[model samples]
Target: MLSKFVAAAALAGAVVTAPAAAFDKPQTTYKVFQFPQDRIPRIDGEFSDWDMVPESYVVGQDQMTDQDGGHHNPDKTLNIRVKVGWVKGLNRLYFLYEAKDDYWDFSLPGLHNDTFEVVVDADLTGGPLIDVQHQDIWKPEWVGQRASKTDPRVPGSLTHWYSHGVQAQNYHIMTPHKDKDWAMAWGSPTWIKNFPFANAAQSYKFTPGQSGTYRLEFYITPFDHADPEGPERSVESKLREDALIALGWIVIDYDDVKTDAKNGFWSLSTQRPMFGLASDLPLFKLMPIENAKLEARWSWKVVDMDRRLVAFHDDSVGKATGWHWDFGDGTSSTEQHPIHAFAKPGSFVTILDVTGPDGTSRRSKVWDVQLR
Candidate 1:
């Protein structure tokens, strides 16, 4: 499954083509809020400490429809929804990823198995430095996997899934873009092996009301501007309070059936609509430690098209105690999750103010309520 991408890119001369206007940009950048608790969540795969954080962004398949080959819905392999979370403290930056998929097939002799990947800009540059035509993108700084083989121990590569389909792979953490050769890129760097703060864990669950779900909990010691061990980090890599870092993820699904053929291994890249191209990794910005101030964020869904009724969810950061909503009309609401019906449809400004113990912050959006 994974090998097909490397093979395609090897033959194409480049993994990603020049950014074309037709290939619309996906919502790649998201905001990470401060964790409600002072301590980090244990790598136990529970959402106890993460329920309050907002999902920074979501990537749909609209952007990929223009690719030469028809675009694959990146989120469909995982049930079309991937929720991500981030929180930062003085010592490290934490991340949480949740995917909805029905099957959990790790059985593998080939590379086509259920796998999840994450790319973070170790340098926090928002984008890559070697931008030819805005083509070089931030590659995977960390990757996590579960229920895979544990043989042929390597620093960064995974053991064959066939060998240990029921156990976790030894190498969940990986660093990409170190080498041009696909095999060499799997070599783990010394920093990856020696970094004391880098760690990851995964867990699975099957509930009555929900599909089979997988969650990932991990953290990386934020870097400084100084280049660390290899070429992966430059003067740009630094994880600081309010640091804006580029981040993205991919979920590959085998649909409970295992096979070595590309047809069985359907893949999705976070921002790369054209397979696993290096140029399209989306970004997620880190927020400052939670305090009295506000980190206003939200997620919404359309309830009615003609009536113009929309539902908005507030996932604000900081210690907010009060909320005020302006629904574009003279009417307003104090509800955190408000459903508003616009009297007339065109473009209206929706505003929200979240007040906390320390202060108040405002968030506003221009909603274009259209007819169904």
Candidate 2:
């Protein structure tokens, strides 16, 4: 049976005791360690059309660089790689990385002013992680992340998530973005409380042991994007918003991943959700991203219901900027808009189609037209 996403709180990585017969085994589960690399494979993403290979490790650490030098500004492509050591019995999987940065930059204007990203990529050899600290985006006229500081990661420091900002700042949609008040729950209930993001070459667990040789799908859920009308209503109905978002993951192909050992040696990357206030299972998210906005406005008034369309002339609408009207009726003419009408109307569906700057077409439908 599919449980609510909030199941994250109860079982978010080592935060609590393993339930009875969690992996068909007792509480004593298997463990994964880091080992010397054997060879590197390929990397891919479902959201992108790119490939990467582990170049080298970040001196003294198990951090490997997996890149073709493309993502997130060459200087910012500062990614590090990690892989799980072979586990035979294959008990369970869990991860709890160390977050060593604490400078916040708001994505929007006049709100929070600290920002960072937790990006992950998997290769045949292992998976690389990236911690982005940014600033200076408000100055640009683009519609994307703009961390304006010359030094993004805590301004010369790698602070943790609970540093300057409150605990678990990333998941709760901590901001003054356009419309953030409605965040009374997590997108997915399995979200890690107080800090869902993780570090490079971190740790994670997988259960029921992926049967034999199949693909190890990797995925990610962005920090502050929400879909009120998402397809998985049953999933959404369970956990809080963050957990829901955590489950709304991103994945990389199986062919792009390569496990070091024979059976269950594949590298896995996962995000866990927890309750900041309580170490309770079934942790629910009662917060907001507070950044997204309410798009279309509701409640429009129709002024003259029984008005007149008094049109005289209207032709093959000249490749005009916007369409005009001559309804051929005496209901309205002073109203210079796209809506046209007819004097002898019994039932008509007024279809007003328009094209935007991107050469994309759209339409508006008005029904049950009666000139009587």
Candidate 3:
């Protein structure tokens, strides 16, 4: 039988270099599809695209430049904000990665269970790999039991930053599935890869119900493992930067896909690692605004002196290029000319931000608004 898992080094000291990736191109991948009838149902919530992509996440951040940092360039590290998208019956987050010459770690801080291990079998035309193995790693309840052996030491080990018990308060490794047989050598310094090593860090997401978002991350770097497993003192920061680029990463959401399952199998029993932080993020003003009923251009205006609803000839303003008027009240408006009425009359500071395609804008002033 083709082994469910491949031998990394003849189960011991034999190190075989990995064959080239068969399909260099990524698969047109999408997260698990959500169904309207599922557990949480695709109703009464907000969803949007992840604003950030997975970049190399450094473990030890003792300075502006970390010896164990992934991508040195702040501009390159992931700045996840999730700019746009709709949320639906999304259940869990999944991740698949190969550790050829990189240090990779997946950290899900506050896990709500509901994650899956995504493994892909690359069928390269001219490849030496005719077999592949897939398995899930579960967590053990031992006092301080953790992984001892490390793999993919060509780069550094990012897991050094997260130990099972020692990191309980700040962070902890994701426990694998119980039934699945996986392998990880844990120890003092160099466990996830090799001992006196620069520490590293990474992140992921998980969701308990089909009503949240999912996130994932990965990182890599040059390896230095002579005394077993740990960090090194290399000053060449570019290596860390190069490692980040070499280790491609991404984050995705799956709420629109329709699954026919009426009942959700969403439970925290599973040792799934990656998950969507389901706690509702405070809603910022939506760009394509919300509850406007209109899908086209909308505008609004306010007078500065009396903070009164000053009319700007609703139809007098030529087609506006761009504008922003925060009514300060819960309900805001912007159209050919927007007029908003607060639940009660009060003094409000109206901030208007306007810009045109020709790069021209004029703010009348922060109008002191009084409504009745």
Q: Best candidate, TM-score-wise?
A: 1
Q: Write the per-residue lDDT of candidate 1 for residues 308-341, one digit (tens) a residue.
A: 7889878676777788988777889999899988
Q: Which ranges of candidate 1 are over 4 A from the true structure?
A: 1-28, 55-77, 80-91, 124-195, 205-211, 221-236, 256-258, 262-279, 289-372
Query: Each model's C-alpha lDDT?
Result: 0.45, 0.22, 0.24
Model 3 over residues 39-137: C-alpha lDDT tens digits?
221111121212122222121112112111122222222122211111121211112221110111222223322222121111111111101111122
Higher-ranked by TM-score: 1 or 3: 1
How many clashes in each structure? 1, 76, 48
In model 3, the runs with Cα more than 4 Å from the true position are 1-23, 26-210, 215-228, 232-372
lDDT of 3 at 334: 59
Against the hidden true structure, what lDDT does model 2 obtain? 0.22
Tens-digit lDDT string for candidate 2 (198-306): 1112111221122121112111222221222232321111122122111111111111112211111111112221111111111111122122221211111233446
Error of 2 at 90 (Å): 41
Query: Candidate 1 at residue 14, lDDT?
Result: 34
Candidate with better TM-score, 1 vs 2: 1
Q: Write down the lDDT that model 3 would get.
A: 0.24
Model 1 clash pairs?
Answer: 123-237
